[model samples]
Target: MARLAQVTSSRNREVVAGFDNYADAERAVDSLSDKGFPVEHTTISGVGLRLVEDVLGRLTYPKAAGLGAVNGLWIGLLFGVFLALFTTNAVAWFAVILWALLWGAVVGAVAALIWHALSGGRRDFLSASQLIADRYEVLVDPAHAERARELLQTSQS
Candidate 1:
């Protein structure tokens, strides 16, 4: 997996505001843009970050089996359609689709049940992870920093 590079700046850059969230930092830049400040000279940096993992839901036998069946049904439908394209009889096309659907559902259900059993209930939940920054800083070119800061401060007041 690819990771984001750390943000750095030279002495020529100045900090506008240290925000606790990205939205606040983005709003500061938007204010600068509204005031006709050259918004191109700005960048938002996320600092002091940590990865957060959140559990979404539990994976159970019924849920897994249903998911697998749905996926298989779509695949089977596509395969049937592809096969039908090579033939001219309408009756044969329906027959292929029905056969594919029946077999696909049975195969999918059995496969999911076996896979779930193999897990031994070790990991049975869905989770998502994201990198959360403790703070966000809006930086601008030194030449425009003073004006940007002034505009942001006035807007907040």
Candidate 2:
């Protein structure tokens, strides 16, 4: 926790520039780096952060099964690769992997169906959430603030 506090400490830093979006702030930092500024002393802080969730669609049993199947398929493939290493025959190796994948998919689908049924329609939607900020501020240590401002001004001109 001490290390984390040290890393995130902004005690003597001042905002050199502000932007409505992250891209502009990133570009400013890139400019500073290109101009040989001490980029290590700089940090981009997002202001007024909020969580935005976009509902993709309704969650159904079929969609849940499909998602579970894909996840299980990857797990099966990984395990199959490890198990196949023990087999020397080409035919046996292929057969083992194929069987593992099939079993994984069937098991995953059944499990997802059972889980969906148990949910009792309490939560039944698909959505993605993102943390966004109203503005991005580029801050620099007080000691380097003057040089950073000069470089940013020249770059903008």
Candidate 1, residues 1-157, lDDT tens digits: the string is 1222223443357888999999999988888888898987788888898999999899999988887787788878888788878767889889888878877777787788788889999889878999999999988888888888899989999
Candidate 2 global TM-score: 0.87
Give lDDT per model, in order: 0.83, 0.90
Cα-lDDT of candidate 1: 0.83
> What lDDT score goes with residue 36 in model 2?
92
Candidate 1 wrongly placed segments (more than 4 Å): 1-12, 68-122
User: What does candidate 1 score on TM?
Assistant: 0.57
Clashing pairs in 2: none
Name the candidate that leads on lDDT: 2
Off by over 4 Å in 2: 1-3
TM-score against truth, every candidate: 0.57, 0.87
